[model samples]
Target: MIISASTVKDTSENVEKFVRRNLLGGIDHLVIFLDAPLPDVEELLDGHPDVTCVRAHGAWWGSTPPGGLNERQITNAALISRLVVGFVWAEWMFMLDGDEVARIDRPVLDALAPQQRAVRLLPLEAASRLHPVADPTLFKRLLSADELQLLHALGVIAEPKQRSYFRGHMSGKPGLRPSADLALGVHHVVDTGTGDRVDTVKDPGLRVLHYESHDGEEFVRKWTALLSSGLDVAQHKKRAPVAASVAALLSLGLPEEQTASLLEELYERTALDDVESLTRLGLLVEVHPDEGPRRPRPPDDEVAQLRELLRRAADVNKRMFKPRARNQRAPALIAKLQRGLR
Candidate 1:
């Protein structure tokens, strides 16, 4: 199996330890791509057998002299290369973050005995706003290089949660888009629970617990540091308000009413869920509008609806104007419509 990650030094140790304990009986090999905390990784894999570690940088391009490539584009390039390599030769491979761990009750090989396809479905377990996840899993299908490139073109990997591309094939309201294609789930713990280590995976039979949020600090430091060096750190740092709202909701446990108010205010200028997500990272901040009263927020139920409407509007606007999608203002418009409906 191939697992790809960049800037995952902190959490990868735990993941590696967990994998060593759990996964067994493999005839071929296991390859892991890790980008930072070189010494720590070496320590974790010191005596492990049948494991190959690549001192990989997330960037598709090679390292940047002593520092290594820092930009997201560069990291994406590296991931694509790994995907290409795995798709060609490997029977089954995984694309995941360092903070992520693939969990199963039995051996991974046993799970694959029934499936005959080139790509087997794996589960993705992400934390839920209401409950602490116990066994998080997802049914993920393996992809070839061409399919990976298609997903990249569709903005799946770059911004995985945005459901704009496949919305037509989706159902359910504004919450987690449910799919019957495959049952694989990802237990995303990064922004869900209090401090990220609260088991949020729902299925106990097959589970993977991601400890990256707390463990991957080393990677966080390195990548952002690189970002600060290469680009305008101050500008990247402007995402504070969005980050703060999520903290207020999940960490502080603000009441639904208060949370709704904060989300409403944020939705006027941005997506409420986006603000909540950013807030979970503790990276949100308020920014003044250039003109007008700015965006307005609707009732709680309408928050996600507004986001979807905004996304659709943005798609429509893009086709009509053919203008670049620079911090697109469609979210603001949806916020306005939602407020009007309310």
Candidate 2:
């Protein structure tokens, strides 16, 4: 089965590591869509025969919605999806965010090979090593398998919790059939025919390592980018209050320096100490290394079923409901009008 993976990234940090990890995980090809110009992109792709890089030149930016999906994610789903479908000849395709890494095994690959099937992976959020103010370059440094093990052993970073307060945490990226008419998301795919999400292969073996907020500098940069983009503050007001507040503040002409400072303070107050404390308390468990083949989930064909159901409903409606006569009136009403005229 031909399986390919694609991601749209602007930053140089973790790009090489992300590509290498997917290649090692048995993905047949890697397509990188650069949202912004990265100078070392050519050198980065030089040795990898399977990897391809394409620069978007801000085409993806204009497609961003006011509320729902961010520009980067929309670009990935709408822009990169087309690119992958057009050029890459693959039975199944996986979408990865710039900071996310997929850990796919043999059985998972086998599960993904079937037609009319999509596999949803789990997400593991990685914790940062440095606190307060940390360098962005620290994220660029590749963490060896041994180093990850050591960090887990030392309780510096713990395995991601299976549950999240955020929506769609359990339902991660979809490995989709390329031919399906669908609108892709980071966690799910909406079938265009039925306007419903395609059923997912609910296998625990498929996991994505999400290195969100790698360091203070990176965190600031990410938030700054979002704030500057004029992201809809009202959209995230309930789901993410802090983000909404930041957006509101920026929109109100909050200076960049002041906004950055506020964000740093908020980060320190909210996540930094809490993460350390939780690790110390052993609230977050360490994920053990697994060398065995991962298990495959049964195929789900709910998308096809839903599409058929919708078609039948439409047909039934068309046959049962007839158009009214243009000038027809109720018999009693017509008689009353005639008597009134007389």
Candidate 3:
């Protein structure tokens, strides 16, 4: 059976969507750990079939958290990994974030050969919308190293670092076979007892819909929270280049309005501005995420001050994201992308 776990603190709308999508995608069970107590979200999930809600603040962490985002996620996932393997007796466990949904339409582990102990589902990051709304219709996939180099060389991607390929994580999360020899991780698995990283094979039939930053507001919330928090961004080693930039941004300590405006500018610049160009080069994938049950998606729900601030700031200086007109250089760029992938 395929089970999934997440450590989350998000608006109920996002959480509810995550639940409905996973349910429709055929996940056998879902366990959510609320990093902070979210009564609205928890109540929304209460008594739901095949879903277990665990509060992370209470006895889960001895009544005090480790004071960092990564620790909280890793702690909760490790605990759940033990529970699933030792007591729940599940065959496979997937670690997902609240913004991510697994699209498991076909048999995954069930169809895998016995020797494939670990697997990874590539991520399709949600594309940004011109208006401040989630673009559930379009998502972008990561490029192979060759494609990335070509894009950088052709000046299609302004930033030559890893972040240019995809704004969020490209190291996709893991789906693992439970065993005493392995330990669960935030992104991948490790050899238990040895603390060594274990390798994973890419699963061909599975994909994770990663809404890492659903909109301009979400982009502000995520980056602002990180910059404001005293935690070291370097903790995410794979994102060191990103971390360096974040560190530089943090050093500025600009006023909230200035920071928000600058962030939105950056978002507009880096986000999907030319969908047609990427699509023509076979880089973009269009997908209509499963609209979970017909119930309302909790758009009008109340959230804490942080989310409210993001919404207002993002709205105050709103800008439309019209795609740039195709230029003569577009054809050559597409040719470079296609030819390099070979």
Cα-based TM-score, every candidate: 0.33, 0.60, 0.74
lDDT per prediction?
0.32, 0.49, 0.63
Candidate 2 local lDDT, 72-112, one digit each (tens): 44434433332233222334667777667666665665655
- Judging by lDDT against the true structure, name the best candidate: 3
Off by over 4 Å in 2: 1-9, 58-72, 75-89, 111-116, 128-170, 230-234, 237-240, 247-261, 280-342
Q: What TM-score would candidate 3 get against the native?
A: 0.74
Question: In candidate 3, which residue pairs clash?
Answer: none
What CA root-mean-square deviation does each model show from the true structure? 22.9, 15.4, 16.6
lDDT tens per residue, model 1, 1-342 = 332222334454455644443333111233444455467666665445544454444331234332332333233222222222212223333323443444433243335433322222233222222122432221122234655455556544443332321211111100011111111112121111122221222222433333221212222342344343443333433334434444344456678677556544543333212224333533322221111221122233432332233333322222211111222453344344335333
- The candidate that achieves the highest TM-score relative to the unseen native structure: 3
- Lowest lDDT sum, 10 consecutive residues, model 3, at 315-324
Model 1, residue 305: C-alpha shift (Å)? 52
Off by over 4 Å in 3: 63-67, 86-89, 130-134, 159-162, 228-231, 237-259, 270-273, 291-342
Against the true structure, candidate 2 has what lDDT? Answer: 0.49
- Candidate order by TM-score, decreasing, is 3, 2, 1
What's the TM for model 1? 0.33
